[model samples]
Target: MIMQVKNKYVYRSKISEAKFRQIVRLFALDLDATQISQIVGLSRVTINRYLMAIRERIAKFCESESPFQGDIEVEYEVDESYFGPKRVKGKRGRGAGNKTIVFGLIKRNGKVYTEIVPDCSKSTLQSIIRGKVDTNSVIYSDKWHGYDGLVDLGYGKHYRVDHGKDEFVNGKSHINGIEGFWGFSKIRMSKHRGINKKYFYLYLKECEFRYNFRDENLYLLILKIVRINPLFLS
Candidate 1:
């Protein structure tokens, strides 16, 4: 029997509607493919396909609902974090071994946006900030040279805490919000052991979606996204 999820019909599925809904609900609860397979009585491969489909929908939702429009006027925290296996021996921050660089921006008491970047150089970071953030907004960050000229680039103010000097917060100038998100993302992703580099961005986008809708009902939200954006099925 075909199941109607929101506005679309689930066709060509061997499992019943209740079982498919169970799989999707488990996925929203952050279960891995293996655990979901065991719980849903499906093969691991089938569960993996369902998980990928969910991730694809999340990616599309994030892209279509991106909050970076150069109109954010609030206390914004910005930071960069590396994601990958720990380096045995090498420089840690910035030019670390082989890790993916993710730049993040978060408005205090608001949503967050993250993007995979080639590097955290001044030029690269500045370009993204200029496009995403609004002018005359106060920006906070750690003492990274990449964030150096934000005020000069038209921000209202730029505050930084020198982490190298063991300073984390100075009055209200800190990147704790965005940094906290980095920690949260890493902890969630750790459950999967490791994701492929090729599809790392999709998983990363999923993290962003989760964080953005942390306070809302995510299962219903996922249904809404799937219903509104049929392109996600492609």
Candidate 2:
């Protein structure tokens, strides 16, 4: 339905600009579909669709604003986290089954980027690092075997925290920043009780977008992104 919005903009949507913007506001507030439907007087299904679209938009925005967006000189922290419900009793760490692997990299005091990976293999993780980070920057991580040859990748310096020996901090050799983000993401995702694996990537990117712009007015930022991107609501 290609419709004109107030004679100023055209959108392939069944929703008016005002209604779309209202939905955007509620979504920016982090209200789930039920809460948003109650406030906006829309069906839960409709609200859910809009929310899903919004998350997709947010994912695209985060991808475009990746951490190393020409700012590769600064130091960085990298880590991999496994996300899943506690299904196997007494199982801890990446050995658990049905868990999704996510690789993340963050610039110190800057933005973050994340990806749903097949595994945390050295090749998988390091390839992402090579693509996003230049060798002129310092890299920090835990002393995982996967992170063994970061300096060999031409990085200026590779510092590591030996978590196995409880050596968490050795001056600037800490992955605390990315570790903190992993904790934050787990906590936030737990609130949803559970999510389908198919949509997990969208949720992960949403977390990255949110954390990267945590200090700013997210409502406005999202609104601006939506305005330019335009909504093709069903």
Candidate 3:
């Protein structure tokens, strides 16, 4: 159930390299494990195992890659979203139960970075922003009080869109890019019905990878990452 390649062991559970690559290709195409199992003629359990392996590899690859840094002269959007089961009939936003908080930053026509945070408090969010974003970057976000002190935190400029007033954009300020990412991630995850909370961070990183490489050959890109980080399979 293992194969050694270039002196490194690559896990293979009775799945040939060709078939494994096929499964990965289907995965890149956004097929659910069940759908891929039907096409590849593999059992759903086997397919799901392969997916978990791939997702773990993706998580390692993303961790090896450095966080966003340097000055961002161009505009960038920052936002936070909650991910989890839908609320039955409770208050929305902040106090909703069964929700996981995620913070994200995306540059206009550039890459994106996301993380599962403990909370959306100003201190928590500000620390992350200071580390990942440049000190003088132009940032755009909704009127979330957590992001209120960003201007004083050394950003070149900070703009807010009052979503409470039904305003989503102003002359040159909006979080449409990051918000679009949230929608994209939610829709994609919906196909899986639901993901386990324990592995949600890995799935979240996969979403980040997908969005960051949206303009490139995702299949080849994934293969490249795996090839470079072959030890991730262990």
Candidate 4:
């Protein structure tokens, strides 16, 4: 039995590893609570119970530090992706909307560090860079005016590909990896319409987790899941 904060109640179930796997698979496939309940022949209340357990479990997965330290390889890219809400019909430039800003740092080879940010201001983006990246690494990004000041933050190398002038590359200066990630993320979100903003970060964390560890064995993955949060099991 477990108590979930969002849904007021305690639920008891003899859920197994296989059942948990099905739950995740269905979730990744974008099935909602009603659909998942019907597919699993479980009550809506029971399905929500399992989903809460899964969320709490995945939150624990982030406790372990990612293996990458400092700059990744010889090149790295940083970018921001906005989601949740859009500018009203015609308005633009950070006007009031429900949008959430997310920051990402990706190695040329595809490793990434992602986070939910309150806004895309220079200070906010710099804080993330300071925490996750080494100052000695070369950073690549589009010619966003805010990022122009990163050199003052001690980044030894900075490169910009001016998208405004079609200068995407001069050699190794492009943000393609991170751009592709944002595209994939937006596409995934679009397929599901819109996600509840409160739960948006959780979904982003899951995507990064899956993208970074796509090659592990099924049993090993299950072990990782168990380790992610055994509190729910307890």
Q: Write candidate 2's Cα lDDT for 5-63 as tens digits.
A: 55111255666667777887787777778988998888999888888888888898887
Please give, for residues 47-153, the per-residue lDDT of candidate 1 as tens digits.
Answer: 88767877888897888875856455578889999998786495666748789999999988889999899999999999988888888788898888998878778
Model 3: lDDT of residue 150: 83
Deviation in Å, model 1, residue 218 alpha carbon: 0.6
Better of 1 and 4 by lDDT: 1
For candidate 4, write residues 17-131 as lDDT tens digits. 4665676678656577789988887798877766666655555575465636644435679998778676667666642465788889887775777888778788888888777
lDDT score, candidate 3, position 181: 95
Task: Please give the ranking of all candidate structures by lDDT, highest first, separated by commas.
Answer: 2, 1, 3, 4
lDDT of 4 at 190: 76
**Tens-digit lDDT track of model 3 for 134-221:** 8767889998899988877778598899999999989888899999999999988887788899999989999988888778888887
Model 2, global lDDT: 0.82
lDDT of 3 at 77: 90
Q: What TM-score does structure 2 among the candidates reach?
A: 0.89
Model 3 backbone overlap count? 0
Give the Cα error of residue 28 in candidate 2, in Å.
1.2
